[model samples]
Target: MHEKKYLILYSTQEGQTYKIAQYMAQELGESHCNLINLHEAHTVDFGLYHTLIIGASIRYGRFNKKLYRFIDRHLAQLNAADAYFYSVNLTARKEGKDTPEGSVYIQTFLKKSPWKPKKIGVFAGALLYPRYSWFDRMMIQLIMRMTKGETDTSKEVEYTNWEKVTQFTKSIEKSL
Candidate 1:
């Protein structure tokens, strides 16, 4: 039997979303997967892949505009394939917010977008205060403070649960 082709696309600002995509790619075997950055991708031929996984980070309570545009442009192709979607956000670090139903961003995305994936994931992202610009750092710090999260600008914290990620990847593998 021929090897199944997988398309992994990611839209990341602080790179956490890309990190999750990389983990999935590695778990699925890099040779069988084509990982593309949505920000840099000009066009996508969804027909070339048997499965499509699109991951995007939530920035200031929204997904990247490019992700929406891409989905709008290729909604039919996505719906035809075994498509999966995952959202990365710090809010997911909180209890009861790590599922699609609990994640407001994911819910908003589903309601606002035309395409719905067969599987959905919600993962926690990192907070690198030192990596952000002054304005962003202050804004994120304020949000963190309100949420009772780590607000130290000098520290970088990663909140992703690798075991959950592995489980998600394994689910995809089983589907294939």
Candidate 2:
């Protein structure tokens, strides 16, 4: 029997999504998983992997356009493989918004995309104030204020739930 090969692809703005992908790769064993940035990958042979996982972050209420393009180009391969998707967004920091049904971005992606993932996860993203430009910081602060989130831009805050992530990873392992 051949060892299962996994491909983990991510599209991130502030790198939280990629960080999550890296964590999953580490948990799944580096040798068994291949991590690729959707923006950087010029070509992807999706058929080479037994499982495919995509992690994408929302920026200004949208996933990257490249993500949709990749899905459109490889719709057949995605549907053929044991594929999963996870969306990362600041809105997920809220109590009820940390789920697939509660995540507007995930729901929108599922509705717009031709390929439906076999499983889905929703994770909260980080807020890195220092990494952002002055304009971005202000915009994010405003959004945070409106949502009753952490509005202090002096420090970086991570909202991801590692326990949930571990659970998601275990679920993936169990499915195989």
Point to the candidate with the largest lDDT. 1
The global C-alpha lDDT for each of the candidates, from Candidate 1 onward, is 0.92, 0.91
Report lDDT (Cα) of residue 138, candidate 1. Answer: 99
How well is each residue in 12-104 modelled by candidate 1, as lDDT tens digits?
998999999999999999999999998887888887888999999999999989999998888888888999999999999997899999999
Candidate 2 stretches with Cα past 4 Å from truth are none
Q: What is the model-wide C-alpha lDDT for candidate 1?
A: 0.92
lDDT, model 2, position 62: 93
RMSD, each candidate, Å?
0.8, 0.9
Q: Candidate 1 regions off by >4 Å?
A: none
**Model 2 Cα lDDT, one tens digit per residue, 33-123:** 9999989887888768889999999999999999999998888888988999999998998877889898888888879999899999999
Supply every candidate's count of residue pairs whose N, Cα or C atoms clash at under 3 angstroms. Answer: 0, 0
